[model samples]
Target: MALLTVKNLSVGYHTRKGFLKSVQGVSFSLDQGKSLGLVGESGCGKTTIGMALMGLLPDNASVTDGMILFEDQDLLKMSKKEIRQVRWKKVAMIFQAAMNALNPVHRVSEQISEAILAHDADISEKAAMKQVESLFDLVGIPQDRMRDYPHHYSGGMKQRAIIAMALACHPSLIIADEPTTALDVIVQDQILSAIKDFQNKLKISVIFISHDIAVVADVCDNIGIMFAGQLVEYGRIEEVFDAPMHPYTKSLLASYLTLDKDVVQLNSYIGETFDLINSTTGCRFCERCSVAEATCSLVAPEWVEISPTHKALCYQCK
Candidate 1:
């Protein structure tokens, strides 16, 4: 069985105007020791999906339909207490903004140990501290610097500390949402390398959410392209990058400026942001698609096979 399965998951937020659907009919599965990257524009429901999986949705938001199955158990159907038991022990998350997530008052080691203690309350503090030190070593944080405050650590170090905390309980799955968002290129590469190394060493499943296609391509074996709350394309990274069937995926690749690609004018996809409140009956990318047909605006597209392990939700592909 897959480590994680999200099937037809729909999430919505309550607003002054009306209920706004943020994610709709999203489905994907991840196996053990594998990683899947969810790539999209900022408000395309990438983070929302992560939050939904973690059961961290706010008061105004909820999972309206579908299921989040972790290890064959439906997380959506679990009680709050039952989910809490699984939160850090079974599945953990390295939240966005590592600097802000860490408490400024406590030392980094204390915070990580606290997470361990919280889940395994019977464990002695001495034991927890030993585990924390080992985690520091695992993530490349020096043992002496374990007591340093968040401000004492550099951006990359802070991110590593947060990662250490996430791995404290040895979770089977890790959800990293925009983990390298604000760092410099060098620091970003270091962090990515650390994450990839950890994933391989521990053989952990990961759902890496990011907006940068290049970064996602580097770290993930599988890629899921999201547009207006829907997964438009999904397949092996090599297949999707080499031969994208969806127009949006093609545009995203064309727009990305890479060092290896020849110099060319950066192309932009022309269209307004997708409307979440009043969604169209047809393909969400119809308005922005360069080769959209008349039927694209009137009828929703179904998943069409592009290759054995590749599929796209576009009529053109069919």
Candidate 2:
């Protein structure tokens, strides 16, 4: 059975003008110990999906339709208290901003320990601290620095600390949102390596959300390409990368610079951006898609299955 399965999920935010649809009819499944990456441009609803899965959407955001099935149980149906109990114990989140996630007043180890105690009430404080020390080792932080303040750590260390906290509860799944946001290239590589290492060693499932295609390509086993609040393409990394069916996926690859390419090629999708506030019956990406058909602006595009493992949302691709 799949560890996580999200089906036809639609989420929107109530704005002054209208409801801004952030995610629409997105569906995917992840098996145990596998990693799936959600990649797209800004305002493409990548992070919103992650937030919805974690049950951390803001006050304005509402899940209009969908089923968030984690281990065959609907997360959407869980009450606030049920969610609180399940959150750190079953699913943990490695937030985007490391500095903001960590408290400046407490020691790094203390915060992680508190997370551990909150989930497992019977665990002694000493035992929790011991586990935090072990987590520090797993994430490559020195044991001596466990008691140090957040300010003492660098950007990479802060990220590692957050990852440690996420794993402190020994959850089955972890949602990482832009984990390497402000780090340099070298640090980013280190962070990615650490994530891969623990993911393999611990055998934990991960939902990686990032705008950086290369980073997602590096860490994820499967890739889901989102566009204008919809999943435009989804498949294994090689499947989608080798034969991208959607124009948006092709455009994303064209814009990104990979070492495999000798001569860099960039395709600029020139058109009006889709308005999230307004609902569209036709293809939302029709206006910006380079190879869009004459009927694309009037008709909705259905998912075209290229292979058993690969598919895209485009009539032309069909």
| lDDT (Cα atoms) of all candidates against the true structure | 0.93, 0.91
Residue 201 of model 1 has an lDDT of 96
Question: Model 1 off-target regions past 4 Å?
Answer: none
Model 1 residue 33 distance off true place after TM-score fit, in angstroms: 0.6
Candidate 1 lDDT tens digits, 3-71:
999999999999898888999999999999999999999889999999999988999998889999898
Q: By lDDT, who's the top model here?
A: 1
- 273: Cα error in model 1, Å: 0.3
Q: Which candidate comes out best when scored by TM-score? A: 1
Q: Write the per-residue lDDT of candidate 2 for residues 59-140, one digit (tens) a residue.
A: 9999999999998999999999998888979999888755678999999999999999999989999999999989999999
